[model samples]
Target: MFRVQKLLVFEFEAIYEPVLVEGPVVLVDAQGNGLRQYHMALTSRNVVFSCDNLFKNSTRRGPSDEPSWEGRGQDPEIECLELVSLVPLECLRFNFYRRGDRCLMMLSAHQAHQHLNVKEPMIFEFGGHNFKHHFWYTWRERVASIRVVQPRYSEITGSSPFSSSDVQLEEELTVQVQVHPRPIRSSSGIFVRCYSSSGEGY
Candidate 1:
């Protein structure tokens, strides 16, 4: 539903070379159809980036009888990409009502070092859906060695049912990479998520 309507890029200076900072946030809808609402908040020790549903019925024209029915519903899936240092960070929230019913939200990042002449797809599956996307970053640090760490999960609200000692039921996938030093951009492939049922319960 909420496909990337557009992509705007910008650059800024960080305090430290290869700054120890939380990676940028990129949200993509798994369902890929219908109108869905989104709310996001990004903040650091000093810098704060916050925004709520950027696209809603308020900005669009609806049917005359129901002027508010701006096709803002849910999507089969939605994709959101947020650049941390961008100026219009607050405006990234929007409705993918046309296909918002079944959506998959994804958050991933790439470091400048890993973004060289790499052309392969990375896929993630969650909530009965398989979401896909690519990664690209430019390296500027002169130090031959750099470290990049991405969080496993952005937010955790409640505890899980499984315990540490219990037998693990899920499968894990591993990837091998070659490192290099240069300004590189890595492109990930398109993400897809399939659902057997519709509506918002997940």
Candidate 2:
């Protein structure tokens, strides 16, 4: 008879990367589709949306040291960080919702602020169900610090300043927005490493 030795099982829970929670959160549409592989950062001061392939494979620097959007020949592996949109903290609204099995955080323009370029609310999905409370609380604290209003759906459909008719007028009055791609050396905020058995994380 062979004696069996004791087996030690170490268990752990799944969690999101510290970067995903803190600095760059993947942006998704209303239906949960990724928005051109873009990411957004919501800090206490302002909101910044950027498009990059930092999580992808290539790394080639474009001319002028910034990522070039001028051609597709650019290295796909190059982590090109392109500025998509930037909105001030005071010019936004925040809302949270639980749908099906997912939690969503919505960012929209503040009713009183009309100069923003966001024609619609930007939605970000929280994939960490287990960490939803932590996630919500973290964001709530940041958002609550500012006097932000919850967006109203009716305002989108009703007579609002962002109405279709006003879009042209708004665009005509505002300066043309330009997108520039730059190398993102490091995202803002502290980053802590999270371990996963599968070598992957949200």
lDDT of 2 by residue, 1-202 (tens): 0000000000001111111123234457767775543344444345545445442333446534533355445433233444454455556566665566565667666677755545677677654446544554455444543333434322322223233432212122212112222333344443222211110121
| Collision count for each candidate, in order | 53, 5
Using lDDT as the measure, the top candidate is: 2
Q: Name the TM-score of candidate 2.
A: 0.44
lDDT of 1 by residue, 60-90 (tens): 3444432233455533222123322321111
For all predicted structures, in order, the TM-scores are 0.19, 0.44
For model 1, the superposed segments whose C-alpha errors exceed 4 Å read 1-128, 131-169, 174-202
User: Candidate 1 overall Cα lDDT vs. reference?
Assistant: 0.22
lDDT of each: 0.22, 0.41
Which residue pairs in candidate 2 collide? Answer: 57-77, 58-77, 58-78, 59-77, 59-78
In angstroms, how far off is 122's CA in candidate 2?
A: 2.0
Alpha-carbon RMSD to native, per candidate:
16.9, 18.9
